[model samples]
Target chain A: MPAKKLNLRKRYGLLTRGMGWETTHQKMDDVFPYDSFEGIKITDWDKWEDPFRLTMDAYWKFQAEKEKKLYAVIDSFAQNNGQTNLADASYLSAIKLFITGVTPIEYAAHRGFAHLGRHFRGDGARIACQMQAIDELRHQQTQVHTISHYNKHFNGLHDPFHQFDRVWYLSVPKSFSEDALSSGPFEFITSISFAFEYVLTNLLFVPFMSGAAYNGDMATVTFGFSAQSDESRHMTLGLEIIKFMLEQHEDNLPIVQRWMDKHFWRAYRLLALVAAMQDYMLTNSPMSWKEAWDVYFVENGGALFEDLSRYGLKMPKYHELATAEADHISHQIWSVFCSLGNATGFHTFLPTEEKMAWLSEKYPDTFDQYYRPRFEYWHQQQKDGTFEFQKGLPQLCQVCQIPMVFTEVQTDPMQISYRVTEHGGDKYHFCSDGCKDIFEHEPEKYVQAWLPVHQIYQGNCGGPTLPEVLEWYKFTPEDIGNYIGSQDHARWQEWTGEDKEVKQA
Target chain B: MSDKKNTVFLILQDNDDARPIIESVEQDNPEATIQYQPGMVRMEAAGRLVVNRETVEENLGREWDVQELHLNLISLAGNVDEDDEKFELAWN
Candidate 1:
């Protein structure tokens, strides 16, 4: 005798619905609460479809298989001394940024999804979030395991979890993820799942994964492919939630649209680091930041929004500004990072001739005409034994908490964009209109931002001197300074028998 | 097929994982024409090209997720209308 066969449609409904009994002793709000804070009315929760149609048995089976294969690759990679196979030692700088900034956010996402899984009203939505929560946790673990191998052979990766909480630059991602974590269930899904995952995830994942493939980092490339397979499911959840909300009630549309506006800009600001890493860090880069942005954002995102317009939702506010800035943002951000290199972990140096040529070719309008001359000046300064690092604290945006480095949209790339507003009799500064709008919407929230640079100036971060600050950041001499003379660079030269002067020239 | 119906196509990396999805598309859209490149398989249909979840699950012999198509998706052209039920590519 064989087990009874059940159709997937029936099984999905039965298994997912489980057995819910309405509480008679307690009010519905008191029992299953946290759904109505944003006034998103839901008349029919059953109409919310489960896209994956995943059950616990299938989930565990597939997840176990993914982990098994990934661990196998990790083992083989370690056996091969995989660190020595990258395109160049400087390539590790991208990984350094990733571990310090992005990996911790994966953990934050895990916590956020867990909260959503527990709190959402819809059973389908709860199951979806729970699966994603587990997926995020898996991502964080695999990322730590994958990058920990590099920490053994590298300088800047040793204290990334600590760095994520305390470092000045890392506060960008820390604050961004914290914002999502602290939001209500509806806002969290709209912000993280819908806006960040749907509209902006490709910008973060594709370049780094493709870069990993090109840079001879088999471990990271393997993990990236595996993570992206899950991300495909995550992307669908994003689309589904937005549609579900819009279809549920007319009032939900405005709320969802406002969330779309707020989170789109927030997610875009976070990816500034990715864009800079893609364009400036990778020695054997696959594509320019502008190219990736155009392909992923302008074309693909444009199409996605067009598809959604039928639901009465519009493209995010300030979208045109974001598209226009793609040509210049990465260059602008890298220039800022280079100017402040001494204060940070991970080495920074002038782009090699080939890289400079690539930048000029890829960004003919901005790189050659505007940004290249500045890099040339920095190189000349380096040649004259007068390497400069930006000193004095830069102002932080109240909402975004990033340094005021962004330029005016559709204008000169050098002039820093700034906006000022008065809330509760205290003036607030923002880097762009997007940040300003966010601050104005919730002045109480933005005012409470834990700005790192401000904390340092207030003598709140470990101490007052450079050594004191570096000690507070747990940075070694090898971790901070020019890449040309860093330990990683020296080891690369020794391993490959390549001359530093020849490579630099 | 109707007038002014341009061919819509999807290119997925040719791999073991994509075989079931390719088969699903082939079965779902009877008129779909598939071509093989060095490491990719491109499928084109005259009006609309669809990859069905039910068909893919049958081919995979297990539960199939519609979003899993992105695992092997290299690139695609035309307006995409996707849900749990199917992934359809068309001009309109």
Candidate 2:
């Protein structure tokens, strides 16, 4: 008799799951102890589905081929000396932001998914989380390897690993990942997978990758393509997990809704960095940050929630606030970073005439009316050789850790938006009412937040002075300040045979 | 041209893996026109654009799932109608 072949779906279904569990030595609860602590009621674990239906054999084979292709590109890029091929040296500032703020989050996500893979009771969910865990680790490795080529000649790329841990601006991402990592398995998956990956990921990945391509950075583009391929599968897992949980029990609706609201605001605030990078840092930006938000969020995100409404879910709280702030958020944050460029780990520059015109065309409602005058004034001061930098430290929000830069909801944009609440005989400040609500719900968790500005006053950083703090952050004189006369700009001019100093003399 | 405003379009990242998918799109929707950008490709057609999973499978010589279209998808500008066999985008 000849052996018979099996169907792929049936074989994957059987091999990936449906292996009967043995309880001879220990009970199920004892083996999976962390499954039930979050007050989440899963009536039937069998309802969970792996939408990708990927088997171990196919995953390894496909992934190995992708890695081979990625490495080949990286090798060619290095051999051809790709560092001198950028649109301008100022473009590297966005890459600096990515390495410091985003790469470490990948490592944190890998750790969180590894824990979820072990702890979830559902076989389908466990397998999906385990695969995502491997994908995240690969993302981190490939990202570091791809970007490390620039470190050979660049200044700011040297201490990103160390800076990610100690720098003030970086606490935005560090604290975000730590928040997700510290939660239970359900909330962890809801935060990183559903909120960050499904709802907010394209805003972070797409613009940056396309900007890299447009600016001639092929190394970053290769890494972006590799990582985004895995992201589609992770997104499927995210959607599947939400549907699985909501379908498991009707009681899960309120819990899931609350998680969505909380994680949405958290993830949205973290994307302020991406918004600033897109609008201000890229020398040859593909599109405006407002346009990307309109395309990715208002269009796609609105449709996604409409689909989820079938399961008794609604749009996240403060969804309207996010829509309203799209025109102003990036502009406001770029202004703040420009004023405080002396303290940042990346270079900051006022927009060129070409870029300012693009901004005015893209943001006709806000840029010309509100932000253009301020940027033009700065450009005038820069021409006069008065190089201004904001002198004082900003009061950081206890919940989101951003400076108090957001404006009041209906009031003038000049007035800073804030909410003060008394918790344990101490007043806590938040940037918005949404953040205030989050703290009021979990006062105990948020009261212990490590606010960066507060730590500096308390002498937890290097010293009291600005230079000492900059030293503690591992920044050289070349890494910070305005981009026009910075070392990188000078070198770029020399490389392109457009050195302005000699010609001016 | 103002015709672009009336067209439904899809943009995908350009890479070796997307070749079969592009071929499928060209074969299935003959009225569609293609444009190239740095590191990406765009397909535009008047009124509608459709991507057939069977066509993609024929080009790639494998079983292709419609959901796999997202692996190369960058952006699209129309209402989507998707199922196990087909993915169609139209202004309606």
Which one is best on DockQ?
A: 2
Identify the runs in model 2 with alpha carbons over 4 angstroms from their true place.
A1-5, A19-22, A499-505, B1-11, B26-38, B41-53, B60-92
lDDT of 2: 0.82
lDDT of 1 by residue, B2-92 (tens): 2645566676655788899999999889999998743456688865899999999999999987756755665554555666678877755
The digit string of per-residue lDDT tens for model 1 on A39-82 reads 88898878887665666666777778778878998999998899
Interface RMSD of each: 5.4, 5.4
lDDT of 2 at B69: 68
Per-model TM-score of chain B: 0.94, 0.91
* TM-score for each model: 0.90, 0.91
Please report, as a residue range, the 10-residue window in candidate 1 chain B with the lowest summed lDDT.
Answer: B1-10
Off by over 4 Å in 1: A499-505, B1-16, B19-49, B52-92
